[model samples]
Structures are given as C-alpha cells and as structure tokens.
Target: MKILVVGGGTAGTIVANNLARRLTAETRSGKVQLTMLSASDRHMYQPGLLYVAFGQMTPDQLYRDQASLLEPTIDFHVDPVKKFMLDKKQVMTEAGKIHNYDILVIATGSRIVPDETPGLTEGAEFFYTEESAVKLYKRLREFQGGRVAVAIGVPHKCPVAPVELMFSLHDYFKARGIRDKVNLKYYYPIGRIHTIEAVAKWAKPEFDSLGIEYETLFNIKEVDAKNKIVKSEEGIDVEYDLLIVVPQHRGMEVIERDNLGEGGWIPTDRHSLAMKGHDNVYVVGDTTNLPVSKTGSAAHFQAEVLAENIASIIKIGAPVRDYDGKIYCFIEAGRDRATYSMFDYETPPDLKPPSKPMHWFKLSYNQMYWTSVRGLL
Candidate 1:
C-alpha cells in the first residue's frame, strides 16, 4: 500500500519515521511505499524561534535541510501541494503532478494569519517566521528602551511563548541597565492568562513580581502603525515604541481548499486522531482541532498515539491506540528560571506545582535542543 504524508514539519517527520519503522518490520516481504511532500528544503525548528528572537539561538541552529531529516525509505517531494482531490484520493502539486495514495496523512500544520487583524501586519513585528525573528532580534538589540507591548491573537501555538518573550525582554533590559526606562505590557483575548488554570495561577505571581502589566479579555482590534498605537475592542488604547504581536493562526491552504477542516482546522477524533469523515486519513500536530495547547510536546505525544493506531489498522484492520490529550509546556521566565506544566484531558497534571527545579529541567531541555536538530529525539 502507498502512503502519502504531506508537510515535513515536526508532526510529519515523526509520523513518517514511526510508520516506516513499523511497516518495515510488519510487512517483512512486501514494500510499503511512503512519500513526504514539502514546499521548501528548509526544515525550521519552530520552537527555537522564540530563543532566536531573544538572541539565545543563532539562525543556523533554528533550521536544517528537510532532505537530511527524512529517512531514505521515504520519497521526499520538495514542492508545494496546490490542491487535494478527496474523492479521487490524490494530491496535485504546484508543478501539475499528481500523487495517488491508499492512505493520506495531512500534517500541513498551521500558519500565522497576520492579515486577520486590521493593521497588525503593517504595524507590529512578528517572530513567527525565521526572517521576522532575525529582524526582531536586531530591533531588540538596537532598542533604546520605550513602551513595549506583547500581545497574543487567539488560538496560537505554544500559548506561553509570548509570555516567555516578555520575560526575556524584561531580563534583557534589566541587564542593559535600562529596565527602568522600558514598560512591558502583555495582553491576551481570553478571560484568563492561560487556558490551563494551574498555569495561569503560577503566571500571575510571576507577572506581579516582574511588574509586567497584563490585561485579560482584551482583544486587539487594530494597530495604528504610523502613530505607534494599538486599539483594543474594550476601548483601550496602548501606545508602544516597539510591538510584538502573535497573529491569528489557521490551517494551511492545502487543508482548507480540500474541505478537510472545519473553520480552517481539521476535526479529528480526540482519541484516534482520525479525520472525522475520512477513515483513511489522519491528522496530528498543529493541524488537528484537539482541545490542547498546540506545542511541539503535544505533537510528539499525538504522533506516538496516532502511529500506534495506524499500525494497528494496517496489521489487524482495527484501531487500538487512543490519545489522552496530553501536553507539557516549559515557560521560560528568563535568568535561567522557568515553570513547567503537564496536563491531560481532564485537568493539568499535578506535577507538584511550579518550582525552581522545573527551571533546571527546562534548562537541561534547552541544552538538548541539538537532539531535535540531529533527529535523535
């Protein structure tokens, strides 16, 4: 049977690897053809982008060639997916080539929709892309200290990243002896700081200690770039010399055009991660509309469960694995201290609450970032 995995991001890579390893051993004699499609050769380490903005990681460390990350058993297509014909079970590339597959995995992931917000794309700088991260790094270095605002648009990956950025910025200015001249403000659309209540509780005290002003349920309506002003739906006007905005996110165009998603995100079974209507299709990582934080750790856990179910289906024509909506996040609070949160479907796991030991754990993980680069993780 032929399997086509689209998109070569974190989810795609892990799923492809797991499937190849499983099918090779199970099939024994017959070949299980696997192919991966991607738009570019650059495989970005998205999680590292946050560190890149803080000048902690270099550009070279944040990206690698996609070809190097894949196994030789899987065919790699370095072209964009222009369209997907669901009825025909084929994917057509921008180059006018079509690929037929017995089973398809849509791991195209989500993209930042900066245009969704009025004037956001024009006014504020974003750290989502490699180029933008580099630019933001430069801007941060040359900054002379002024009102800095960090805001989050709804439904973003790594929910705590913006808060981490704020902490890092605060530490940066404090070390430069200009902390007193800078004002940092964090705004979120939700009624609470974090979707996970345990995390929000931990974050409140941190914000209080850092003296960072936070506004919840404050939706940013528009950005007045020329005037360096941000207007919220609550009639709050925030003036800033520098703005860091996390734009709105949506499923990739490939998924949207094929009607594979609901409101731009693929709807999947919370347990099996199989597409709601299509049995032969599965989605993992940031592509799925799961009730969990869209972080790399969440994707990793989903990949493990999804791979097991796919293997079961291939071997016995039945699903065996189930996802528990697991997610773990490390919130960097600068100066080598961070808070960690572990959660599942019911509630955030009780990891004895956030403490300094969690900070060390985060540090150790950061040092092992090379493991992901080497594809060892």
Candidate 2:
C-alpha cells in the first residue's frame, strides 16, 4: 500500500508519525510505504504565535526542521503539491513529479487574508504570522496611551484568540502601568461576544471586571486609515489610535483552484474524516469544513483517529475508530493565570476558573507541543 500525506502542519505531522509507528513491520518488509510532502523544510508551532505577539516567545523558538520531527521509516519531501487529480488518484508536485497513492491525506492549512477586508492590512496590526506577531509586539511596546480597538473577523482559526488577546492586552498594559490611560474596546461581528455560548457566558464578567468595552453586531466593512476610523456594516463607525484585527481566513489556493471545496475547505465526513464523495481521500485540520473550532487540539484528535483507522485498514482489512469532534483549548486569562475548555460534538465546553497551575501547564505544553506532534503525548 502507498500512503501519501500532504502538508506538514500539526495534523499532517501527527498522522504521518503515528502511521509510521503503527505500520513499522509492514514498512520494513516493503509491504507498505508512507510519504509526506510539505511546502517548507520547517514545521512551525502555530499556537506560539500568540505568545510571540506578547513578547513571551521568539519566532525562532517556534520552528523545527520538518524532517527532524518525522520518523525515519517515512519518506519526506519539501516539494508542495500543485494539482490534486482526485479522480486519477495522483498529485503533481511543484518540482514536476507525479506521485500515486492508494490513500491520500490532505492537511493543507488555512491562511489569513487581511487584504480581503479593504484597508485592513494597512490600518491594523495582526499576529497570525511570525512577522505580524513581531510587528504587533513592537507597536504595543511603543504605544503610550490611546484607544486600542480590537476587531474580529469571521470563520478564522482559533475562536478563543480574540478573547485571549483582550486579556493579554489588559495584563500587558497593567504591567506597563498604563492600563488606566489606555482605553480598550472590542468589536465582534456576532450578536454575542463569542460564537460559543459557553465561552461568551464565561468571558462577559471577566471583560466587565477588566473595564473592557465591547460592541456586538459590528461586522467589519472597511477601514478609513487616513481618518483613523473603522466603519462597520451595521452603520457604526469606531475611531481608534491602534487597531488590532483577527482578520479572515481561507484554505490554501491549490484547494480552491482544484474546485475541491468552496474557499479551499474540503467537505469532510465528520465521523470517518474522509473527504466527501471520495472514499480514498481524507481531510483534516484547517482544511476540513467541519463546524468545529480550528485549533491544533482538533487537528491532534483527528490525526489520531485517522492514523488508527488507516493502519487498521492495512493490517486487518477493516477500519476502527471515529473522530468525535473533540477539542481541548487552554485559555490564557492574564496575570499569570489560565483555564481550559474541553468539549466534543455531543457536549459543550465547561469552563473553569483561571489558576496559576493551569497557567504553568499551558506554558509547559508550549515546549511539549513537539512531543505531541511526534505522537508521543
């Protein structure tokens, strides 16, 4: 059997590593082959970007050589796939090589599209990437005192980020002794502060205690950079000194060009994690159009399920396991305290009070992320 995994993000890395460990005997006997193709030679710990924005971590600390993280039994390449001929069961890489596979895993992740919102890229600071995180940190450091407006865009990865950013900003300003001088305002597109009802309920009191002002039903339309104003589709205009935006996200261009899915998100089976209508093809991570929070936790859970099912199919001629939409996310509640949310498709997240131990655990996980990706956690 020939197995090809594309994209070397959290989901892809875990799936490949787990499969290599499970099918070690088959691979050694030349009965099965495992391969991975990625766009770059380095794999990034994406969650660390949030810490980067707060000056808690450096960009260099978030990366490891992609090959170093993969098992030696798996063949890995730095060439990115350009075309997905699903019907033919082949993918053509940028280096002009076509690889055939009995099974294919597509984990091409999402990307931030600030330019999609008019004037946003020029007017606001965002931290979805390393450069943007560094830039936001510098701007926060240089800021004296003014209205710091945080605007959120829809369908973005990490639903809890805006909330965490709010708390982090409050703590940062307080540490700088300018919390009283800086006015913090948050603008959310939905009717509530967050899409998840449980999260919204949990954060409202926290926001009030921190004196964070918020405006709901305020969808971002465009930014008037010259006038220092942001106009919303709901006929409200907000003026700001510094604008931090979450920005919109879309899947990779290759997925869009191939018409595999609208906005590059492949329609996936929620239970089996297979691409809709294609039995041999699977989807995971930010590339799936599942109604779940797009976080590394979700990717990890889905990867484990896929690795198990695929290995079972090869060994026993059948599959086992199903992805239950499970996700666990750590919420940084500022002031060296933190909490977590654990949920699945059948259950809503129950939040706990922030504590120092949870905060330390979150910090430890930042270093342990590499181990998790290696299928050790």
Candidate 3:
C-alpha cells in the first residue's frame, strides 16, 4: 500500500507520523510505504505568528526543516505540486515528477490571497506570514498612537486569530503605557464578534472592560489604504492610523485550477474528511469546506481520526472512525496571561477569563509541539 501525503503542514505531519506508528509492521514488511510531498522544506509553526508580531518570538524559532520531522524510512520530497490527476491516482510535481499512490491524503491546507480585496494587500499589515508579522511588529512600535482599526476581508484560516489579535494588540499597547492614546477597534463581517456564541458572550464583557469597541456585519468593499480609511459595502467608514487586516483565505490555487474544490475549497465528509466521490482520497485542515475554525487543534483531532480511518480502510476497505469536530484554542488576553476554549460540533465552547497558569501552558505548548506531541496529546 502506497500512502502519498501532500503537504507537510500540521495536519499532514500528524497523520503521516501517526500512520507510521500504526503501520510499522506492514511498513517493515514492505506492504506499506509512506511518502510526503512538501512545497517548501520548512514546516512553519503558524500559531507562533501572532507572538512574532507582538515581539514575543523570533522568526527563526517558528520554522523547522520538514525533512527532519519525518523518519528516514519515509520518502520526503521537497517538490512543488503542479496539479493532481485524481483519475489516474497520480501526483504531478513541478519538476516533472509523477508519483503514483494507492491512497492519497490531500492536506495542502489554504493560502491567503491579498489580491482578493482591492487595496488590502498593499494597505493593511496582516500577521499571517513571517514577513507580515515582522513588518507589523515594526509598524506597531513606530506608531505613536491613534485610531487603530483591525478588519477582516473574508473567512480566514484560524477564525479565532482575529479575535486573539485584538486582545494581544490591546495588551501590546497597554504594555507600552499608551493604551489610552490608541483607540482600538475591531470589525468583522460576521453577525457576532466570534462564530461561537459562547465565546462571543465571554468576550463581550471583556471587550467592554477593556474599552475596545467592535463592529459586526461590516463587510469590506474597499480599503482606501493611502487615505488610511476602510469602507464597507453598507457605507460604514472607519479611519485608522494603523490598519491590521485578516485578508481573504482560499484553498491553494492548484486545487482551484484543477477544479477540485467548490470555490477553492474541497468538499469533504465532515465526519470522515474524505473527498466526496473519491473514496481513496482524504483531506483535512484549512482546505476542507467545514463550518469550523481552521485551528491547529481542529487539525490535530482530525489527523488522529483520519489516520485511524485510513488504517481501517486499508485493512478492510471501510473507515471505522469519525471526526467529532473537536477544537481547543488558547487565546492570549494581553500581558503574559491567556484564556482557553474547548468544544466540539455538538458542544459550545466553555470559555474562561485569562490567567497566568493558562499562559504558562500556552508557552509550554510551543516547546512540546517541537519536541513530541505523543506525550502532550
């Protein structure tokens, strides 16, 4: 059995590593072979991007060589995917390499396209990438203080990140002793500040206490970046000294070009994460069109569930496990304190106020993730 996993991101790495453990016997007997295809050699710790912007972490610490994360027995290829020939069960690489697989796992995730919104790419600073976070850090330091508007253009990966960004920004400015000088505000298209009603309810009082104003249903129609103003379709206008935005996120262009997604997102079973009509192909992470937050925790749980299902499928042609849509998010609430939320599809998030103990746990997770998740999980 040939298992080809595209992407070396959080979901891909978890599934690949766990599969290697579960199929050790088959792999040693040459009955199962594992391969991972990555566009870049680096596996970016995306959750650390916020810390980088807040000057809490350095860029170098957030990335690891993808090749080092895998066992030597697994085939690790640093090649960009050109397209997918699903009908032929072939993965076409940019270097003209074609790899055939009996089972393919598509964990390519999603990408943020600044070009999706006019003036957004050029106008506001985002914290999704290393360069963007670094630039935002510099810009945050240089700004004396004024009206700061954080906006969202479209649905993004890590849906909770924008909310967390607002909290961190508040903390950032407060630490500088210029919190009053900065009139911080947040705007998102959703009807509520957060998708989870319980989370929003928990944040409402917190936002009220922090004097942070927020506007919902504010859809961005144009970003007048040069004028430092954001205009929404409803004629709502906001001016800002600094614009922090979470721009549009879509599935990889390759998935779109190959017509494998619905509006650049893969349609998969919410429980199994298997691509519809493609029994042997599976997907997880941001690329899947699930009405859930694209957080690392979601991917972590999905990876475990998918790995088990794959093992069962290869043995008896039926996936026995199901994903519960579980997610855990640790949100920083300024200073060195954080709050946590845990939930699944059937349950609402149980949220609490920020505390120092949770903060320490959040800090510890970074090291734990880099070392080994088996114990932590």
Candidate 4:
C-alpha cells in the first residue's frame, strides 16, 4: 500500500521516519511506499525561534535541510499541496502532480492568520515567523524603552509564548537599566493567563511578583499604528511605543478548502489520532482539534502512537493502538531558570495535581536535548 504524508515539519518528519524504520524489515519489504510533501526545503525547529528572538539561540541552530533529514528510502516532494481529492484518494500539488495513496496522513500544521483581525496585519509586528522575529529583535535592540505592549490574538499556537515574551521583556528592560522608563503590559482575550486552570493558578503568583500589568477579556479590535495605539472591543485604548502581537491561528488552507477541519482544526479521535470521517486518514500534531496545548512534545507523543497504529494496520489490518494525549512543556521564565508541567489523559479514577519542577529540571532537560537528537535522529 502507498502512504502519503502531507507535511515535512515536526509532525510529518517524525511520522515518516518512524514508519520507514518500521517497514524496512524483509517481512514488510515492498509493502509500503512512504512519501512526504512539503512547500519548502527548510525545516525549522520552531520552538527555538522564541529563543532566537531573545538572542539566546543563533539562526543556524534553528534550521536543517529537510531533504537531508529524511530517510533515503522515503520519497520527498518539495511542493505545496493544492487540494485533496478524497473521491480518488489522491492529493494534488500546486505543481500539477497527483499522488495516489491507500492511506493519507494529514499532518499539515496550522498557520498564523494575522489578517483575520482588522489592522493587525497592517500595523503590529508579529513574532510568530522567523523573519518577523528577526526583524522584531533588531527593532527591539535599538528601542530606548517606553510603553511596550504584548498582545495575543485569538487562537495562537504555543499559548504560553506571549507570557514568556512578557517575562523576557521584563528581564530585557531590567538588565538595560531602563525598567523604570519602560511600561510593560500583557493583554489576552481569555479570562485567565493560561487555558489550563492548573497552569494559570501556578502562573498568577509569578505575574503578581513581577509587577507585570495584565488585562483579561480585552479583545483587540484594531491597531492604530499611525497613532501608536491599540483599541479594544471594551472601549479601551492601549498606547505603546512597541507593539508585539501574537496573531490568530488557523489550520492549513488545504484542510479548510477540502472540508477536512471540523472547527478550524482537523477533528481526530483523541485516542487514535485518526481523522473522524476517513478510515485511512490519520492526523497528528498541531493540526488536530485536541483539547490540549499545541506543543512539540504533544506532537512527539502523538507521532509515537500514530506510527504504531499505522504499523498495526499494515501488519494485521487492525487499528490496535491509541494515543494518551500526554504532553510536557518547559516554560522558560528567563534568569536562567524554567518551570515545567506534565499532563496525561489516561490517568486512573483520580490523580494528583500537576507538579511544577524547579529550574534545575529545565536545566537538566537542556542537556537532554542533545541526547534526544542522538536517539531520535
């Protein structure tokens, strides 16, 4: 059977590689043909971009050649998927090629939708993309310090990123000896700082101690860049010398145009990572409408389950595995320290509350990063 994976970023690369390794044995030889289609040759470690913005990581460390990372046996197509022809079980690329597959995995991740909000695309500076982050960093270094506002648009990837930016900016200004001259504000439409109640509870005390001003339920209506002001739906105008925006997010357009997403994200079985409507289609990572934070660790966990399920289907023609929705994130709070939380969906009747490890855990994890690369790749 032929399998087509329609992305080459974090989720796509991991799934494809895992399948290649599993199906390489003599017993499964010639039984599967794996192909990965992506729009660009650059594979970015997206999580590292946040550090890049803070001058913590260099640009070279954030990228790798997509072609070099894939297994030699797997076919890699560098092209954008134009549409999905479910009727024919084929995917059509912008280059006019149709790839037929017995099984299709829709791993196309979400994208930032700045244009969804009026004036945001035209006025505010976005830090979601590498190019934007670089530009913003340049502007930030030259900034003399004043009213700096970090606003989060609706439905953002890595929800904690805005808060991280807030903390880092606090540290940035304090180190520059202009903490007194700078006024920092964080605005979110959500009533709480984090979507997870437990995390929000843990973070509230930190915000209070840091003296960072925040406004909740404040939806930005427009950015009057010419006037250096952000107008909210609540009739509040926030003026800023520098505006850092986390733009709105949406599933890949190919998913929406082809009616693949249920609510701005592909609806997949939380346990199986399989698309609800299509038996042969599986989705992993940020594209899914799972009620969890979209992070790389979540993708890695989902990929592990997805690879096993695909192997089971090919080997025994049965979907025997399920995902547990397990995710762990290291939230950096600057000052060479970080906080972390581990969550699992398959807990027993009652489990203990989430635990927050000290900065030492994060420090040790940084060393483990090298080990992870060695083991996974």
Instruction: Assess each prediction's global lDDT (C-alpha) against the native.
Output: 0.81, 0.94, 0.86, 0.78
Each prediction's TM-score against the native? 0.94, 0.99, 0.97, 0.91
Q: How are the candidates ranked when ordered by TM-score, highest leading?
A: 2, 3, 1, 4
Model 4: per-residue Cα lDDT at residue 220: 81
* Higher-ranked by TM-score: 2 or 3: 2
Q: For candidate 1, lDDT tens digit of each residue in 1-377?
A: 78888878877888877777777764345557788898888787787788788788887886778887776677888887899887899989999999998888888888998898888988898899888889899998999988989888877888878777877888988988898888888888888876667667777788889888888887889999999999898888999999899888898987777787864689988888888988888888899988778888888788777766787788888878789888887888786777777788877555344467777877677656445433356
Q: State the TM-score for model 4.
A: 0.91
Q: Residues 1-377, candidate 2, lDDT per residue (tens digit)?
A: 99999999999999999999999999999999999999999999998998999999999999999999999999999999999999999999999999999999999999999999999988999999999999999999999999999999877999999999999999999999999999999999999998888889989999999999999998899999988899898999999999999999999999999999999999999999999999999999999999988999999999999999999999998789989999999999885989999999999888898899999999999999999999989
Best by lDDT: 2
User: What is the TM-score (0 to 1) of candidate 1?
Assistant: 0.94
Two-way TM-score contest, 3 vs 4, winner: 3
Evaluated against the true structure, the overall lDDT of model 2 is 0.94
Alpha-carbon runs more than 4 Å astray in model 2: none
**What does candidate 3's lDDT look like per residue over 1-377, in tens digits?**
89998988888888888788878788888999999898999888898999999999999999888877776657889996898999999989989999999999998888888887888877789999999999999999998899999988677888778878988899888889999999999997889988778778888788899999999999888888889889998789898889999878888888999999976789999998999899889998887888888878888889889988898887788889789889888887765778888998898887887799998998998877865423125
Tell me how far the alpha carbon of residue 237 in candidate 3 is from the true structure, in angstroms, after superposition.
Answer: 1.2
